[model samples]
Target: MQSYDVRRLSEIAYDADNGVTAELSVVVPLYNYADVVIEALNSVVEQDLTAVSAIVVDDASTDRGGEQAARFLAQHSERFATARVVRHHRNQGLSMARNSGIAWSSEPYLFMLDADNRLRSPALSRLLAALQCSGAAFGYSQLRWFGEEDGIGVADVWDPARLSTGNYIDAMALIRRDALLAAGGYATLADDHGWEDYDLWCRFAELGFDGVFLPELLCEYRVHGASMLRSRTNDHFDALMAEMRLRHPALLCSSVVGVNP
Candidate 1:
């Protein structure tokens, strides 16, 4: 996964001589996670699926995280049909990193993985099947709070009404790239530290795109003090919430129902 121009992504648009194109693309965004980026990518390349593409987005980290990711992807280059790494010259926030990956992906379905998190084996398979069978725009599975093995995060069934209150959708879910692009990839929040995932879910609900929930623990959410959401101070949260309200008041409703438009 050597770094490319970061602008060549096309959906299943690879050359015929390159054999079958990928069906799914996993975009990994990293920033100064040299110690954990390899493990994060390993979880992806180690998956059983073959028609998969992994895009490593090195978010202009001040560390060796990008180099480590490139080397690891290079070692496992043969595992996927197509894989590549794209590096940012300057530090763009997570939202930009993911939005760039979305722009550069050539697959119908996508999974946005953080450098510190990992996907469980067979989880992708299930999520893909759910999306295909239901003809939904995206699907997410239950998550396990890593280190809290005795406990699990059980996601409720699909409820568009509930989505308006708060975001229960973890960023690890598999989404249809088309729908994502249609609604707009992601919003750039103030200081680039907004609740991007929550904003995305709100937008999806607004678009009336079909969403599904699969009741299976398919990913692990690593808990640490340095996590993006955790690193923010209470003041940040208050400011972000106020901004969210100002930007998307309709999404903050409590009894919103029926996403069909």
Candidate 2:
């Protein structure tokens, strides 16, 4: 895939009045997760919010996931009002995939949902309400974990106050599109600390952008064998963290030490 400056793309594409006036733009990036792509797309479509638009970026999936996602969009195009599907010719990392989605979105607020995750009925609505009411640049709800078991377990609530102490916002959370662009999107991380969402949250905090956490469990984050967390590329994650600390000393503290309280 060709490399383009995400910031430049965002500046050129950030037009709030041109497209739908939806309260949220849900961007889902899919790779080879063909088995779950339809379900993920359906989850967003099923949301009760009428003004929401979803943009699914197919990151050059070698499998049928991209085709399946295109079919879903074709069948339920009206439900989302303005649903778009983008494809990359070659496989790019998650960071690039997400950046593409952001560039394609015109909504003021954005939600980053993984292809394996599904949102609860009112998840988008609740998160948007919190952002509106609190005037926070970003907002997220409690995430529930699901798998083979009917209900494996529920994740803990994300406390916005504790955000500075650690990474609280996951990629499945909601954020202001402009704020995300201002923070320079996701950074390329090393093996150990390459979790894209973690790096983004730290950057958000450093920029003085605030996020609100609704206590409601508004989304289900599925963890399967193919999940990125399970892959655990430690070297890449660590290298990313090291670079992040060097780039933003105030946000990450020192490369050797954990986030400062």
Most lDDT-accurate candidate:
1
Query: Each candidate: RMSD to true structure?
Result: 5.5, 4.8
Model 2: how far is 258 from its true place, Å? 7.4
- By TM-score, the best candidate is 1
**lDDT tens digits, residues 91-144, model 2?**
767887788888876788889888988988888888888888988888877767
User: What's the TM-score of every candidate structure?
Assistant: 0.86, 0.82
* Model 1 misplaced stretches (Cα beyond 4 Å): 1-19, 147-150, 254-261
lDDT of 1 by residue, 1-261 (tens): 211433432222121213558899898988899988888888887777767888877777888887788777777777776677777767778887887688766789999899998898987788898999999888988887764233466466767677655557778889998888787787778845537877788778778887888888788877676765455566566676676667667767434321210
- Candidate 1 backbone overlaps, count: 1
Q: Report how far residue 99 has shifted in candidate 1, in Å.
A: 0.9
